[model samples]
Target: MKNALLIIDMQQGLFHGPHIPYAASSVLSNIRLLIKKARSSGTPLFFARHTGPDGSPFSEQSPLTQLIPELDVNVEQDSIFIKKYPNCFRDTVLLQQLKLRNIDQLVIAGMKTEICVDTTCRAAFDAGFKVVLVSDAHTTIDNPALTADNIVRHHNQTLAGPFVSLVSTEEWVA
Candidate 1:
């Protein structure tokens, strides 16, 4: 199957606020490795950046809206989608780009496990694309009620069970 890597909303804004599944530095490392692998294999890479309304912290020109420093992104090699909502495909060109490339499978990684990541995965599945969710390659801050670890674990198990194929970075790289 033709595959592509979709890195969603790994922006600095999400890291600054009190969020759940606190953005782990390690997730970036794993995502970087996946980017390298995808590049070497000649697979397509798509980046999603979330943009909030004017005056918001996540506004288009805000530094926080930028991708985190951990990812070695090359504009020449990657296609970037600026999204207004959690679901990357919502009114975005992501689906069109994937369709143009004939990408039937997606390897999804990035921030906010229960929100953006989960939403995008479902959208991709609904769009008729097979999804491979990198179980440990995404994260969020701790919620007031649940620890970050537990939240991550819950989404990984739950999302993987019925929504997408859960794979580790090791398995993905292999």
Candidate 2:
């Protein structure tokens, strides 16, 4: 089972707004750990950046679309996809890239638990790829009705149910 790592929507825009997810700072260490493991294991790492419509702050040319500095992303070694929709596969070359690499499994990590993260996981599953959602590697902002931790826990426990496998960064590295 050849696998690749998908780091989705960990953009600068997400770091400086009210739209930012809660406790995002807390997950950086876990994400960094996953990145290191993926690199050491020779797993291909792909990054997804959200691009809004023309003139929007997060548009293709905007700095806001850049990967967050916490990850210290190296664009030269990583594949990058600029997506307009929540699903990384939508209108993007993500699927083609995976297919070209013959990747059958995906190790996913990133932000906005209820949106981009969930969307990509479901789409990947639907595309016939096995998905591993690194529980500690993804996070979201706090909502009025529920804490950020609870929101992340809920999705980690139940998003797309059996279609996706939920595991921690440690387990993945192990």
* lDDT, candidate 2, at 136: 87
- Which tens-of-lDDT digit does each residue in 43-112 have in candidate 2? 9999999988889887899988888887878889989889999999999999999999999999998877
Model 1 residue 59 distance off true place after TM-score fit, in angstroms: 0.9
Every model: Cα RMSD to truth: 1.6, 1.5
**Per-residue lDDT of 172 in model 2:** 92
Cα-based lDDT for every prediction: 0.87, 0.87
Find the 10 residues in a row with the least total lDDT in model 2.
15-24
Cα lDDT tens digits, model 1, 1-174, are: 999999988877775455534547678778999999999999999989999898997789999899877777888889987999889899999988999999999999988887899899898998899999998798887767887788888989888856799999999999
Pairs clashing in candidate 1?
A: 20-140, 20-141, 21-140, 21-141, 21-142, 22-140, 22-141
Question: Against the hidden reference, what TM-scores do the models get?
Answer: 0.94, 0.93
Per-residue lDDT of 45 in model 1: 93
Cα displacement (angstroms), candidate 1, residue 138, comes to 0.6
